[model samples]
Target chain A: MSGFLTLLKRDLLLALREGGALGTALGFYLIVVTLMPLGLGPDLNLLTRIAPGILWVALLLAALLSLPRLFEADHDDGSLDVLALGHMPLELVAASKALAHWISTGIPLALMAPILGILLNLEARAYPLVIATMLAGTPAISFLGAIGAALTLKTRRGGLLLALLVLPFYVPTLIFGITSISAALLSPAGFQASFLILTAISLVSLVLGPVAAAAALRQHMQ
Target chain B: MTTDAATQTWTQRLANPTRFMALSGQILPWLTIAAIAVVLYGLYLTFFVAPPDYQQGETVKIMFIHVPSAWLAMMGYLMIAISSFGLLVFRHPLADVSAKSAAPIGAAFTLLALITGSLWGKPMWGTYWVWDARLTSVLILFFLYLGLMALRSSLEDETLAAKQTAVLGLAGVVILPIIKFSVDWWNTLHQPASVVKIDGPAIHSSILVPLVVNAVGFSLLFFALHMKAMRNEVLRRRVKALRMAEVEQAARGRDTSSATAG
Candidate 1:
């Protein structure tokens, strides 16, 4: 457990020190969310209707953009091999990486979503749900991304392959994430089911992601 | 290390590339014949015997091909994963062949699903494509197949190619569960599962019999095609080995002749 925490802290610190790793994603999210209104014209009602999908997609792509770096740097520096042999389990290492990713990528993206929400002319009432759905959802993407990262760890083109492998797995989360927020805004009762399903999926992936990733990492290491 | 009795194991028997070459060579023709017969009969039953869906009409005929092909596509991924596990754990040569052969067959199945789906969709949904969960996930599966095929070709070393492709095949298996649960979890235009329900398949027997027959036919077709593919790979590898031997023999002759001339 301590080892896992240390791994998590180290990755978090690495991400923090690596300038623009987190910022680039947030910047992209901001640009996409802000630019939509410009392209679609200033219609708050229309924006409100499309805001949830736009926010979800922006976050999805942004999360994906940062995914390759998760394993590439460690693999290059041979830290990944060292970690593979460490006293800690590979799954723990994977979990810590995912945790670090969520903090570095998911959390920051969630925080910036609401600000972008305003640019999209989203109502004040929808802000919480948008933030809430993102907060619950983006971690799943990071977790799923970790598996792809592990699989393509030794591949020549890890980044592109990572997206190809992971994005399909992202669809369910993306759908639920967008739907939950839209449901929250449009109909209160419909929101809970989607949110609950989204949360359930995240929780399930949270448990399974590390194990599957570890299995994938083991294959690569061998 | 293997005694004659030990050769009874499927893994052991298939481990010998030459053995697989011979076995598949003998079986291929018969398998092909059976596959053709079943598929033709299945298609006949699907078109003529199976009653039209009240909701979908003749357009419903597409389900016989589309749904079964889709099922096989998913099943092919699972097969690839199992073969990959075999390669990783047992380091069996035939396991690599199994994974290699299954990919193109899976891709073909996925393509069939997509094409037939569009054909059905045109008349039923009034559109050739919808960005629904099922359709999108199927598309993604197609891409995964393409990725695996591309990855296999990108490597020069045969062993490395097998290992790398195996890793990818295992990872791609994760998409299966997500696709399965997509309909139930999300509010999608795609209808919920009617077959393989918690209770039982809701489908009526009139349509169900032909569906099952076609499903079996498709599975058999996949097996037949995969065997043929594996045989082709074995032949290709044999030719490569023979060519390498010839090159080495030529090099030895050149070395000997040059020494004599000197």
Candidate 2:
């Protein structure tokens, strides 16, 4: 457990020190949200109706932009090899890195979402729901993204390939996140069910992601 | 001890790629003949014997192809998942070949399903597409297949690629059900409240017979294609190995000549 925490702290420190990745992701999120109204014409009613979807989709893409770096940096610097040889299990290493990714990248993306919501004319009441659903859903994104990052660790130009591989798995998370927010905006009754399911998806990915990422990393190490 | 010995020999024979090549060689012609014969018979039945639906008329005929393709699409993924398990857990040499060969075929069938489905939808649903739950799920399945193929092709290392692809395939299998469930939930919420549900017509004996025949025939065809693909992959690996050996021998010759000069 201490080993996991150390690795997590190390990763968090690296992300903060580097700082550019998180900034680029947030800027990308802002750009994508800004482009939507221009593309569709500035119809406030339409923007309000589709705000949850735009926010969630753009957030997924933003999270995806940083995914290829999840393991590439460690692997390239040879720290991954030392970590692989450590007392800690590779699965735990993967989990810590993914958890760190969620903290450093996912949380910031989720928090930035509500602010971007203003640009899309997102309903005032929906802001809290959007923030809540995104906070719950982004862990699944980071965790699942770890699997893609690990699998593509040795590939050339892996960013596009990682997107293709990881985005399909994001379907359930995206569906639940957007639907839960919409349900809350439209009525109170359906929101709880969708939100709970979204959280369950995050938990399931939290477990499955690390194991699968470890398996892929092991193959690459071999 | 005798039974154990017998089982060992059986598995050894099955596991030997050379023996597999010979065995599949013998089976291929017969499988091909059977698949072609059955498919022709099925198509005849579909066209000549079955009556058009009362409601859909000619458009109903599309179901004969569309449904079977969809079934193969799912079955193809199942085959890849099982083969991946065999490769990863049992270290079966042929399992990777099976998994690799199954992907393109599965993807092709998935594409067929989508195309036929939309063609049917245009005449029936008055549009070429809708975000219907089943269609959406299959579309995602198609994307999964593409991802598997893309991941495998991107890596230059064959052995590592095989293992990585297997890991992804298994993850896909685990996630498929959740994706289906979520899509269904999303569809229900967004589906227009008053849209009349169009339940499928009851399967009459006439329609049922042709459908079953086509399904069986198509399944047979899928296996034949898979077997043939496995053969090609085996041969390709053999060629690669031979080329690698030749290069190694050439490099050794150069090293020996240089050593002698030194």
Candidate 3:
């Protein structure tokens, strides 16, 4: 347990100290949301209606932008090899890195969604729901993205491939996240159902991501 | 105990790639003939025997192909998942070949399902596409197949690629049910109350017979293609191994000549 926390802390520190990774994802999120209005006229009502979708989709893309670096830095510097040899199991090691990714990248992206929501002229009522869904949803993104990151750990120019591999898995999260917010905005009752399902997706990925990523990582190490 | 020993030896014999190649060679021709015969018979029944639907008319005929292809598409993925299990857990040599060969065939069937589905939709639904639950799930399945193929092709090491692909395949198997469920839920949330279901309540015997026949025919075809593909992969690997051996030998000859000169 201490090893898990230590690895998580170390990864969080590396992400913060590294400087550009988080910024690039945030910048990409901002740009994607910013471009939406220009692309589809400055119709505030139209933007308001589509705001939840645009926010969630853009957040997913932004999260994807940071995924490739989740394991690459450690894999490159021989730290991953040392981690593999450590007392902590590789599955927990993977889980920690993924949790760190959620803290460093996923949380920030979710938090930024509402701010971007303003640019889209999002409904005031939907703001809290958007944050709620995103917070519940992004853990799945980080964890599932960990599998992609680990799978492509040794591939040259793996970013695009990782996106292809991971994005399909993101559909459930994207669906539940957007729908929960939309449900809350349209009707009060359906929101809880979708939100709970969204949280369920995160829990599933939390277990799945580490086990699968560890298997992939073991293959790479071999 | 003697019967158990005999069964073990039988499995051991089949596990040998050379033996597998010889056995499959004998079976391939007969399997091909059976598949072709059944498929032709199915098409005959589809065109000549199966009556046009009361509601859909001739466009309903597309179900004969579309339904079967969709079944095969899902079945192909299951085959890959099982083969991957065999490769990863049992360490079966042929399992990797089976998994690799199943991917493109599965992907092709998925594409066939999508195309046929849309073609049917244009006439029936009055649109080329709708984000219907089944369509969406199959589309995601197609992407998963593409992901598996792309991951395998990008990695250069054959052994490592096999293991990695197997890992991804198994993960995909676990996620498929969740993806299906979420897509279904999302569809229900967005869809209008009066939606047109493709398979209307209790298919009639006339429609059911041809659909089942085509399904069986297509499944046979899928296995034949898989067997042939495995053969090609086995032969390809042998050639690669022989080439590597040749290079090693040539390098050794040069090293000996240089040593004598020195």
Q: What share of the true interface contacts does each candidate keep?
A: 0.22, 0.86, 0.73
Better of 1 and 2 by TM-score: 2
The residue-by-residue lDDT of candidate 2 on B1-262, one tens digit each, is 5686577865456678998999999999999999999999999999999899999897777888887887799889999999999898988899999999999999999999999989998888888888766677788899999999999999999999999999999999964564335444554422221111256445777888888899889999999999999999999999999999999999999999999999
Number of clashes recorded per candidate:
0, 0, 0
Q: What is the lDDT of candidate 1?
A: 0.84
DockQ for all candidate structures vs. native: 0.31, 0.90, 0.84
Looking at model 3, residue A128 earns an lDDT score of 91
User: Candidate 2, residue B249: CA error in Å?
Assistant: 1.8
lDDT of 3 by residue, B1-262 (tens): 5686577766456678998999999999999999999999999999999999999998888999988897788889999999999899988899999999999999999999999989998988888888766677778899999999999999999999999999999999864564335445554422221122455536788988888899889999999999999999999999999999999999999999999999
TM-score of chain A of 2: 0.99
lDDT of each: 0.84, 0.90, 0.89
Candidate 1: stretches off by over 4 Å: B1-3, B6-8, B46-55, B154-158, B177-209, B243-262
Model 3: how far is B179 from its true place, Å? Answer: 6.8
* Model 2 / residue B208 / CA error / Å: 0.9
DockQ of 1: 0.31
